[model samples]
Target: MVLETSSTAEASIRAPADEAAAERDLARRAQRGDPSAYAQLVRGNQGRILRHLLNLTGSRDEALELSQEVFLKAWEALPSWRPEARFHTWLYRIASNVAYDLLRRRQLVSFEPLPPDHDTPAETDSPEVRLHAKQTIGQLDAALARLPPEQREIVLLREVEGLSYEELAAALAIDEGTVKSRLARGRAALAQIYTRMQT
Candidate 1:
């Protein structure tokens, strides 16, 4: 459901050719007044949209509501989607902006878990190793909670989404230099916290 589209910026996202082509084709058809085609597009993208919302809201219930809202908004704005930008880019931009707006309005703290797909910890060679690994991950998660939302978002985009500076910039509506600086500072702060935890 990802690969085959030349417009997709994510080089690593792999999906069937027919599926990818079907998305653009459906989108193209939807633009041309095919209601069923639009439904297909929503079905194809709902999982990704939900994941984005879940990450942003840190609650499955809230994510489901927000995801529904995103699709509703997408449907309303579909006609305005410029052909120059990839469909996913347009969708993500809208979703991110909406999430930002919602967060600003709610003044809520995000309690999102460490991404489930984070790099795997090596298997423990001993009980001590297992304990240490658990302790380290817990410490990191605690430290992550202490970070500013901007810093946390940057970390998530880079580590979980695997987006580069350019993609990160676009996703966050920031400049490339800003992305680099934020990432550097975020890493430095994380290192400082981890160092403190060791003592």
Candidate 2:
């Protein structure tokens, strides 16, 4: 049993590296104009890209529309894509640009409350506790919508999407120092806004 558990742990740790390698191979094939390979790459990444866009745009309809545009732009640019960057990271760069453009054109930020979480607090939490949790999530979402798009994107990509500093820089076409400073400011602003909302 112990050996089985150890093996499972090791396999879990290796999964991301394995997935990245597979994606790189697919990207190379797509670069050579293989439609099937490109489809597979899109299938593997679309959900995450969609979710990321949804967070950035705060609109489901816009996110769905922008996700298709991101993939289309990726296909057009595939020939120039380098293997050194993770395929997903490159896709996100395209997505980031597309989203930023939309935000700039709209000149407004709006966020609905995040979808209700069905799995949290176990089944035993009191109604009051559950209500409080829901309210807190709503407040956080509102705070995010209030932030400038530039800072909001950094905060979402770092905290919500779990990107490392280097990945954030590559995805946003910014330097690591910029990513760090923006994320710091974004987080501080979010905290202040959330605090104000709670009072």
Can you tell me which runs of candidate 2 are displaced by over 4 Å?
1-5, 109-129
What TM-score does each of the candidates earn?
0.67, 0.87
Per-residue CA lDDT of model 2 for 1-199, tens digit only, reads 9999999999999998999899999999999999999999999999889988888887788999999999999999998899999899998889988988897898765555445551255458899997777777777878888888788888988887788999899898889999899999999999999889878
Would you list the clashing residue pairs of candidate 2? Answer: none
How many Å off is the CA of 20 in candidate 2?
0.8
lDDT tens per residue, model 1, 48-138: 7777666666667777888788888888888887555456656777777777778888886755555543334667557788667767776
TM-score of 1: 0.67
RMSD of 2: 2.6
